[model samples]
Target: MNVALVTGGPGAATVGPCTAAPSPDLHYRLPSAFNDASSKNGRAMPIDLDEVPSRGSQCASAGKRRSWIPGAAFLAVLFGSIALAQSPPGTPPPASAPADLRQSKGVLLADRPDDTLLLAVEAFDDGSIGLVVSSLAPRCRVPEDVFDLPVQVDRAGFQLKHVIRQQQPQPDGACAESIATVYQAEHYWPLKTATAVTLHLPWGAVPLNEAGLAYLKSITPARPPPALPDDAATYSGLLDQLTELLAAGRNQEARAAAEKVLPYFVQRPPDEGGRFFGILGTARRRTSDLSLAAASFEVGIRLLEIAGDTHSLGVVSDNLATVRRLQKRLPEAEAASDRAIAAFESLDTPGGKASLGGAYNNRSLILWDQGSPELALVYNEKALALLKVAYRDDPQALRPFLEDNKFLRKAIKTP
Candidate 1:
């Protein structure tokens, strides 16, 4: 059995140190029941990853699903054809496909043989997640490579560069020097973990050959995705996809997707109230779904402790508080702001400090709305103080999140 750990999202997967140890059942793929699975602090580790096929297995088991992976042979065919540019005419392509085709890799779920090698496992506040064939290549690159000439830099930019520097390929790493191909690093990552890790290829392209696809498909089956909230604000999948789309510059599509998914929260769907409200709130606010947005954010905050991310509860609380403050809902907003501020301030990481300060700035908005400009001033002062002491010297480290001059004004306006 093999597992690969990956993280990104609003909540932190770093919450529990329960043990990276996989259960014995997970150590090897058994036909039926998995062994003693451990749930850290009561929340099962989203220990998502895939188990590669054991080399010693009989040839039959290595390529066929019932023979090996339940539906792998099917995936092998699709990806095989795709890898060789053999797609039949009229295959659907996502909007970013043509321009980004050579760089994209994704899993295909065709009905022919039925087995698949791709699975998306998400753990909130950590990172969006997915799995795919090891041989699949990635099209995404580090952001700084946009210049026609080498980007000019000095000590300051280099210092700021370390924030996400480790993500770049290193001299000794397995990936090739060229940005166009990623075969080397994929071969080098340890895909064998006790728990199964899912593979997440790009949407328009397949990265491997039939043999490689078939081999990866033979690895393992995914546990079904967890129950999703009916409301739009808190829907993990929608938000994750939206964020990815936004980053990829497919904004029009993301806006449409958000509009389709987030409204269920506005009316409070009976079957899934709290969950729906949260996702709806997030969708509304972020996608300009403002009127009912604050209400949705509040519901999400209320559902936090029961949800996978305790940290996001804090984030939503702050988010809802901001919307409420914007709309003149003073009392509820103030209480929410207090909770949000306290939550971020309690943690020690640089992220925690920055988020905590953001909470303060958000709180000031509420105070100003509540007819207490004086208190608002105090909170603004606090936000500026934190930013200066902890982030100003290397503010560029904030990158795409806070690089705009308009955003920088927060620090100067605090006084």
Candidate 2:
């Protein structure tokens, strides 16, 4: 049995007007733990590639309740810059792997310079292929058309699949200097299918080994491209429905809906998988299923890393701390919260402060549980101060913090 000291408040979504307004999916408003939902309006926020990712959270009193972190669903064209002239279906005959691709160390393409190019091939499940020419230096520039020579891919000594020269910036920020030139290869390779192939770059020929084949297979295949609704409102309406379901305590339903809509997000710039996993993690945590909840958040972290969404990554990290705390892993929870605070504090964006506040509040709980009431009070006060900035638009959003302040104020005075 659960002691419902304070009821949870609602989550917001940004859906189209097509659907009926959703019920108040109020997040729990207590002092026990903090809720870090990514959106403020109780709906999903738009995923802006230009903006760093940030999420929203609500807090509740001293009791077990769901941590609601709302994330906005975004739909955008994946690899819009590259025009993939769809490849023909059918796996090419397999041949022995080549030695060049098998080199433990990536062969450098450029001469003695600050930057070097490590050539690699990335093939996705959707049959979209790209030759990634990654620049080794952190701040280096690669040529706009890096692969001008006649590139070749042969399966069992057969060549001549149509290749394009659509050079584009690497989506992942970790490799800020990397560039990709997409290719439409024949047939999609499943995860772990080792095939003999060669990349005929102008600098030299880079052959792939069976291990290289497996490496390409291991790369997180981009989600299959989604056929975005012709009407933005329809998409919005769909997002709204998802939010309402999650807010209404329909955890399983929300997870199912997120999975169903996932494939369509493939090829998009933002890591939609990260956002969806975050949503699923929240729903699972609410149900007190800690193992599954942690798994979901872990996956979200990976996807965000792949997407290079620093802001969203911070938001997810903050939310993970709350989940770890609920699982009674105080040390892990504290570490996660600290990491989240660091990430958020690095951002100058509007959403960063609120995220930082939520992390501080979460860390406060861990400290309080560890008998550090004084430190807890300090963090609690910090949360209140920062959250005030985050929820300025909606005074109602700050209700839980106000309650926390009242409680912490008294608790600090007790000693």
Candidate 3:
């Protein structure tokens, strides 16, 4: 499975938040997920692709149910006619075709085989047109040359219609085999007055088939996107700088950066709440502000628990335990670590198991300091085994824990 977002700074000379390793899961907030100030946290409020506007839809048609056509044979027929400039010698002629067909007017034509092609058209208020065309072949991609599609719309009563060419065709990577492409173009015609239009592709003047035309007309127009919150960009920039500063062991700078974004924590969704506060807690811990670190982590934990974000909850709780340990709050620290372990166990992934290892190690340290070396040894050993798997990708990543385990082993041997 792909690892989720893991954001934390490195630790100091001893075991702490940074040394307590969690797998890397960077959940960057892309613009598409949250266009406006309020919609920034889509993890808790994921946008429905189908409900998005036609021009701005981030929909993935991959893995959906589709009535497919025989791709190879159909393309062969369509392109074959183009290559020879005529129908095959023995092939029957196409049935009588319609005239003055246009996309906006909802002109319908006869259906082709299921595996042929699918097209969706969207017209905007500013005379802009968007087209989504997909090749239905199971393993075939749309030929690169076909992307240079040029078409002319034949409006009734006008001697000539507007001609448009695809300046760009963005490929949709979601589909495994078929090529789903989107084209955005503009026309000079008055969209409302156009009674009929015909698309003149390289192969021929293809009328909008019934299914294609219906699908195009059914699309909802996109709304003008909302503006972002004034502080959104600044807050994000600060968090990024904080992560970098913490990574570089510049605790003071990291703490200051965290403070800049801390006020906005309440406005974030659970996932982002856990992320920002967790980062803040790290900065506070590195600077030895145990109380502030614990406070930040508590808020983060509350948000994660409310959102059922167990994965982040587990990592942040582990960090909180470390801060509590530094403050000599043994009971509180142990309790927090226990919660972390529980959260990790529930995750059941490699990253989760690795996080649990860090929690176990922290608990072992607390137990050792409390004069229970024998009991601490058991937890330490368990931590070592789990951490080995967690850092399997880079054994050096486990160096700190490996050294700690070795020290614990030698200490337990003493009288």
Candidate 4:
């Protein structure tokens, strides 16, 4: 599922601990997709989040299993960027629909300006061009108070206006939120090529269309990625347990369980393998450890390749791109986002649709860093719309946490 919510502390509150020290109640239900119970040490102890060592370094290795796959969860806050996925080569040509998209009329699909990575853009006979902006982060303009000792309403309003302008919006509907959604839908793109380019005004609605997001409503049954080949039933059961622990904010316990499930990860089906690695990688990042997180994603990507899963690989690539961004390797970061976007565009599964959010998230970050927060708002909204669909069933399942509301508001208002 897709993911965030702000006011960022532990991201979620916990009544107690979530440890593998004890078996979860037999009749106890857990959070949807995330906290994995099976990943715990064989003891199945009821190690709740409250019981785990809160002071333990989030990065401290928890004795990983030799057979474990790469990951358990992701922290939406670690690095400050999002993504933009490009359409893949050999896909059906697009038709005019939204201003956000255009055909590649005369322009060539060159490699990313910073990275030497060869791009896979498909130029159409039509002249309209489609450029894949990469490496997105979804932070509202840095909160005014984070800088000044005191808060200024006037300054806040100014920053808010700046954020709104980037969305380029016109309100619709009676409800502000609904109106914002419709306004954003104006910028929505649905696998189509468009003509309009330059925006005369800085303000416009980011795309958050009802139709474009229809796919999001169709949440897949809490199933693992189809490619995962291990004991699907087993991994599925374990994943559910882990999610419960996470939802309740049991980071340490969740981490422990993640390790126990590692061995089954390598040969388990592709979707599951990549997904596991992606989760584990995220868990590492939540603790502020970038190197291991990057390694986890790399391992996940390798597993997905073997599973013949182009879509999951794209997701892993996005994960890798974000990790690179944290390492300050802008060039590599951009290329990874590009590849992730390309991979998603080339796929036909729901994962492809959901993965677009990650691309937009990464791309938004890149724009924000370039002194273009205005543009970043538009892309951030796009990712928000996608995440709404993806995480409708399960939002708070990951660690490090995401600012779902902050980003959602950012999506609606752009400023």
Candidate 5:
């Protein structure tokens, strides 16, 4: 249901190819049978990371390399710059709770001239809870690392410490922007009778009041369909076949199938045609046909715009920017990125915001290629901020963007 977008690697930076993960708000429903098959095959089946081409690489060399790593290990490597102290996984809570509860709160726990801490908490339906603490320090101090360590836990609640490390202040008395570092930790304790949580900082204990325990209780979770509807079976089957072909690394076969089906969808409806064109474009791009990919994305963009599908329009436009960048057409790439950013900006939804972040990331690369590192850094920071907001619940998904920001900053600061 999720689509991967290639938004990384401009002209000749050392950074490798980067991809944006699917936002939760942007998903298409496929038949349950097709979903089952995709799951069994160990593929999301739409656009896997391995299918994206690396920038500055020859077209013939596209899709020739694959790097697969475990999710936990990948996260560890991604956040290695930030300190993380993980507690041992706790045992499951007993099954005698009266009712499920979910709540979240963000409170400013400490405010001082040197340091500030904002604490956020979330309690899940299963009696488990998570805490995120953000520490802000003056950039001149060079706050190097931040982490959280669990101190104690029981039915009465839990205790933890927020640790911050910084270097000596710069002698010039010059100051830059404030640096914010985040630390997260989760606990499996049953909180049925818990009253409050305490954070043990270097200064004192900051007790966080849990006044709104029922804030998230009224929210409903989505349930999956029991079976694939008969009316969508045929179309779903065809789409599944194409996705499976791509999943199996048969790019040529997938491209052929997409070409065979593109016309029929194009005649049916604007939305359908737009989606299929995106598929066709992805297929062609995977096969190293940059011109055909750009052409397909153009058609898709027009169709999506006609259908008033701003989300898909943004996606297609972003993909076109990638194609143009790969072709070394900086102006065209920047134009496409602008269109994509505008499309996403018009939408106020979370998916739109995340896609907008992706568009900015693409534009940053193009600017970097055009020898505008300062402007590139600006756009990159914007992308990071938007992406962090959208992916707050799934911080691991921000790995690529985080890496890009790190490398871009290093590049900007290097002589």
Candidate 6:
């Protein structure tokens, strides 16, 4: 009964091409499910990754075949750990960790409890080492001390100590629910002679397995630069500026900025042009300009198709469907939703499956709003089935979608 009604517009998870470098400042918030659940009783209960249900258990309850597909945001967080080495432009750098706590080369350590603590060590070509420490905690209880904690490193390994403080009652005597918070700290050290390194966290010690050690050792001090068009840097800078504006929730400014720079990408490669259009569409949608949003997405889809970027194509197509739905263009919305599902189906990857489920959910909403409750129910069930598989390990993340499905079913059953 923790379900909240699905009001307002559809969920807007931003999208970009998989291979494109993300803006260093771009930070994604946890899904609305977490936000909603945290505030339900004013007790800010964040989902602990350690308590996630087993895949077999979740699948058995859903009565569907279990499939493992990582959510898009989940994967993004994993990859984003490495990018944390440098603070965003204009942000003050944090206090350095003690001298003994030298950083190391970037390698994702496995064999730790998922989503608890992530440590990414990156070795830069400049002989500098970077370490990014990340952990999740309740919004009101961030562990700011993790940044300055001393790390002990020796030929054997490195050890970092962290202790989560208990949540003290708020000044108002009640903790307000807020989105789950991720606290991260970056530290740098001078590179030293190559040595096998192990990370000892408070929970456990994780050694660099053979592959990790080899990867750390094999990193070239410098990489050959790829040939680039003269305007590449300018183009990248423009996109980065736009991404920053959007991430900061400056919707009107982002729309204007996107429009100003969009023409530059028109004659570029399809992927480049498509990426611009996608940003433009997102900005327009956030500004409540549905017509322009749909137009941008349509153009982006064509360019992505020409570029053979099915992932971005699926994403833009879904965005178009949502815009068209808001515009009450049922036929067009349904067609766009179908296209998105088809594009995701072809990819068959974990991110693709997660997106495919979202497309199904979009189609259900469109059908229901178009007065086809029966058909909507069918699509909703299909969406739930796929999402159950996609989020088998993190059922808490699936709560919002489940709540939406429950609402849809109840509405359909009502006289």
Candidate 2 regions with alpha-carbon error over 4 angstroms? 1-189, 192-241, 247-249, 259-270, 392-395
Give the range of the ten consecutive residues with the poorest summed lDDT in model 4: 174-183
lDDT of 2: 0.46
TM-score of each: 0.35, 0.44, 0.44, 0.38, 0.45, 0.44
lDDT per residue (tens digit) for residues 174-231 in model 1: 2111111111111211221112222212232233344434443443323322222333
Error of 6 at 68 (Å): 62
Best by lDDT: 5
Give each prediction's root-mean-square deviation over alpha carbons.
20.8, 19.0, 22.0, 23.8, 23.7, 23.1
Write candidate 5's Cα lDDT for 1-415 as tens digits: 3223444453422211222212223233434443454322354323211111122222222222212111233222222212222222222321311110011134445456554444444433443233344444453332223322322222222222223332222223322211112221111222222344444443345554444223222222222112222344466466666667667776666765665333234223456556666776777677666665676677677667777888888888998998888877789898989899999999999888999998888888888879998898899889989999988888788877887787888987842
- lDDT for position 253 in model 1: 52
Write down the worst ten-residue block by lDDT for model 3.
157-166
CA-lDDT, candidates in order: 0.37, 0.46, 0.48, 0.39, 0.51, 0.49
Q: Could you tell me how far off, in angstroms, the CA of residue 197 lies in candidate 1 after the best superposition?
A: 34
- lDDT against true structure, model 1: 0.37
lDDT of 1 at 375: 69
Collision count of model 5? 0
Q: What pairs collide in candidate 6?
A: 105-121, 105-122, 105-123, 106-121, 106-122
Put down candidate 3 lDDT per residue, 35-55, tens digits, no spaces: 234423332322221111221
Model 4 Cα lDDT, one tens digit per residue, 1-415: 2211111121222121111222233233333223333322332223232111222221121221111010110111100001111111221211211111112111211222221111111222332112211111122222110010110111110000000101111122111000000101111121221221211111221231333223223222221221223346766666656655656766555555664445334334556656676666555455454554565666666566666677667877887777666666667777877877788878767667667776777766755555566676667777777777777778663211256336544655733
Residue 312 of model 2: what lDDT?
Answer: 70
Runs off by more than 4 Å, candidate 1: 1-239, 246-252, 259-280, 393-415
Model 2 per-residue lDDT tens digits across residues 221-240: 34322223344444444445
Q: What TM-score, to 2 decimals, does candidate 6 have?
A: 0.44
| Model 1 lDDT, residue 323, Cα | 62
User: Clashing residue pairs, candidate 3?
Assistant: 4-25, 5-25, 5-26, 6-25, 69-114, 69-115, 101-197, 102-197
